[model samples]
Target chain A: MPETETFVSKIFIAGSIDAVWREITKTDEPQGAMFNNRMHTDGLALGGQIRMRTPDGKYTGVIGEILEFDPPHRFAHTFRFTHLEDAECVVSYDLKEVDGGVEFTLTSKGVAVGSKTAKQMKSGGGFICKTLKAIVEKGRLPLHVWTIYHVLKALSFMAPAATKSENWPLKGNGDAQPA
Target chain B: MKTDSFDSIFQALAHPARRRMLDIVKDTPGCNVNDVAAAFEMTRIGVMKHLAKLEEAGLIHSEKSGRDRRLYFNIVPIQLIYDRWTMEYSGWWAGRMVDIKYAIEAGTNPQEPDA
Candidate 1:
């Protein structure tokens, strides 16, 4: 089998597996909280529909159907958007009970290596995992304080880039920062 | 949207050896093609071909002094990739949490539910 690329994010949730499972598999709740507002989904049965949208609407939404549903353990679904076109990918969550709580792993699979989707899926795993931890533990997520500073830097980078004397690339070691 | 530099950047970075070659050129700015390949115990011509690809990708440039060409890193294309890959995502990723702080601490009650 061709080894497909996957984006894996692991989070330790203090909540019980059932509670986390409810959060992941629950449907049709009032959609306004940090966890609830980001994604809206219909029934989560096999072939059920799901959609996730970024708050700013920059990425629009990824709409898809559930491909696997094993409550309190695994949930997976198809993921597609206007940006991704027809490249089919699956997003899955696997929950395992740990010492004090649950170890949650979110994975996005079937991404072709070196594609933009691959990059997004890779980085997105970190973002989503951190956001999930923040919401489950703290009741909501907050912008990483550093993110504000980086956003301005990013805008500057988009402009006519300066030469390397300015340390222009900013030289992050490709590790995901705390969210 | 793909840029012309995008493919070259990924292609140049596809191999661990090539990336190591770039690192060698980076530490020793005046390093020659043979110098990069020697670090990996590869043939000189083989390293020359690798450096050629790096040069093609705009990741490094060479200057001929006498008969030897000294290699120097040109990070513009790498910077472009960094801009596209990291900065672009950070913008929206931050936005995803814009209202989260307020949502959690919404009222006097600390244990308030997210409505």
Candidate 2:
């Protein structure tokens, strides 16, 4: 087997197992904010397909076959985005009860070792874990939402310019401050 | 999106020498290469290589004036990275809260009328 890197994040939500499972598997926008890209899926069952669109309107679809299904406890699936023909990763969600709430563990594996995607996923996993914890504890979206939106907007501007020039002033870490 | 940008940033910061250089500039802005080199035990040329990597990652900026080039830390890129990830996770949490609210309501009023 080839060496692969994995990213794991766990969140404890004040909810029941069934409710948490439903939120993770179902709930699409403009109904819920779980996935912004407007996922089109049949259901959370074996051999189900999942697809998501980029904020820029680009589409990446994946075939998600359930590998493990333990009601209200665990769900695992194999995912492959359309752009990554040679890459197929496994994402699993494990739920457990603790102190009148549920602990959700999200794990992604089979990412290419030492690859850029793996690094981003690792950083993203940490940030997501922290943000999820904050939301659950405070019971509200963060006030810095607009700051985040603008950051993404800036990236959209700089990404194309980066390909053109090596010394572009816009090129830097993803955490660039907005101009 | 060009995902490689994030990788290059991390890769540039992967080295301890580069990270230390960043920390120094962040603490004391407008420090020249010689000033940064004095803090490290490595030779001046060795430190320059690390600074070059950081400059490439856009973590630091340098400007030459007269005989010295002053280096300043740029923190905007790091901030952008933090914002994007935070928003996505926050969205997930909001969805989870909705499900929880419904579950709690349903559990409390099994006999009550559904509205």
Off by over 4 Å in 1: A1-3, A29-38, A53-60, A143-179, B1-115
DockQ of candidate 2 is 0.02
Q: Write the per-residue lDDT of candidate 1 for residues B16-112, one digit (tens) a residue.
A: 8899998987666566776777787778888888888877675775667699987766544554455455655685776556556565556533345
Alpha carbon lDDT of residue A70, candidate 2?
Answer: 77
Q: lDDT for model 2, on a 0 to 1 scale? A: 0.59
Worst 10 residues of 2 chain B by lDDT: B1-10
Q: After superposition, how far is residue B74 of candidate 1 from its true place, in Å?
A: 31
Per-model root-mean-square deviation over C-alphas: 20.9, 21.9
Task: Provide chain B's TM-score, model 2.
Answer: 0.70
Docking quality category of candidate 1 according to DockQ thresholds: incorrect
Best by lDDT: 1
